[model samples]
Target: MLQSFYLILCILGFVLPYSQFVPFLLEHGLDIKLFFEQLFANRISGFFGMDVAVSSLVLWTFVFWEGTRLKMRYLWVYVVCNLLVGVSFGLPLFLLIRQRQVEQQTD
Candidate 1:
């Protein structure tokens, strides 16, 4: 059930953002400067960006260390998902995968 929930969230994460970004890109033609301008346009936006940036660093570090410690495959998968997808998607997805791995060990 949790896995299903996370999967749903993951799917929505991609779907919802692509819904906007695709259209924006189509209209803007890969406007990197405008992207950053909008991203850090205000203090609130900058705060959120900083929040995500810090959390991403933390998440990547955890994924790397924990993955190696557990000898887990698909470590890169988590990293890529975190980078390419949002943390809203990646963290829940990672939790789901980690839960399954732990359950397997207990069994």
Candidate 2:
């Protein structure tokens, strides 16, 4: 049941953010150079992107530390998913995996 909760969180996370990002990509032509150009075009964009970068770095650091300490399986899965999608999807996915590990240890 707890795992289900995390899975639901992951699904919502992806759905909510992509609802915005997908439209942007469609409108912007999915060009990598154009994406980066616009990502830093304004002060707000710069601040927001940098903030996300810093936060993602912090999150990954904690992920590595805790995952290593607990010998968590599929640690790379979280990292890869974070890169491919976004933190919204990856964080909850990692939490779900971590929760499963905790449950296993108790069993």
Candidate 3:
């Protein structure tokens, strides 16, 4: 049940963010300067940008520590996903994998 929940979250995470991002990509075609300009266009946007930046760091740290402790392979995959998408995509995906690993260990 938890695994199923996590899977659902992962799907939502990827889809929800990409729903916003894909349009930008289609319109701008990887305009890094414009991206940053818009990302921090105002205080509110800057707040979100900073929040995500810090959250990404936290996620990376947790992924490294817990994943290594559990001897989980493909740790870099989570980091890459986080970079390409966001914490929304990375966190639940990591949790899903971590859940499976835990289940296997217990079994």
Pairs clashing within candidate 2: none
Query: What digit string (tens of lDDT, one per residue) describes model 2 on residues 1-107?
Result: 98999999999878987897798888987788987888899999999888867867876887898888878976788877777677888888888888888888889
Alpha-carbon deviation at 103 in model 3, angstroms: 0.6
Return the TM-score for each candidate structure: 0.84, 0.83, 0.98
lDDT of each: 0.80, 0.83, 0.98
For lDDT, the strongest prediction is: 3
lDDT of 3 at 29: 99
Candidate 1 — what's its lDDT?
Answer: 0.80
Winner by TM-score between candidate 3 and candidate 2: 3
Give the clashing residue pairs of candidate 3, or none. none
lDDT, model 3, position 1 = 100
All-Cα superposition RMSD per candidate: 1.7, 1.9, 0.6
Candidates ranked by TM-score: 3, 1, 2
Query: What is the TM-score of candidate 3?
Result: 0.98
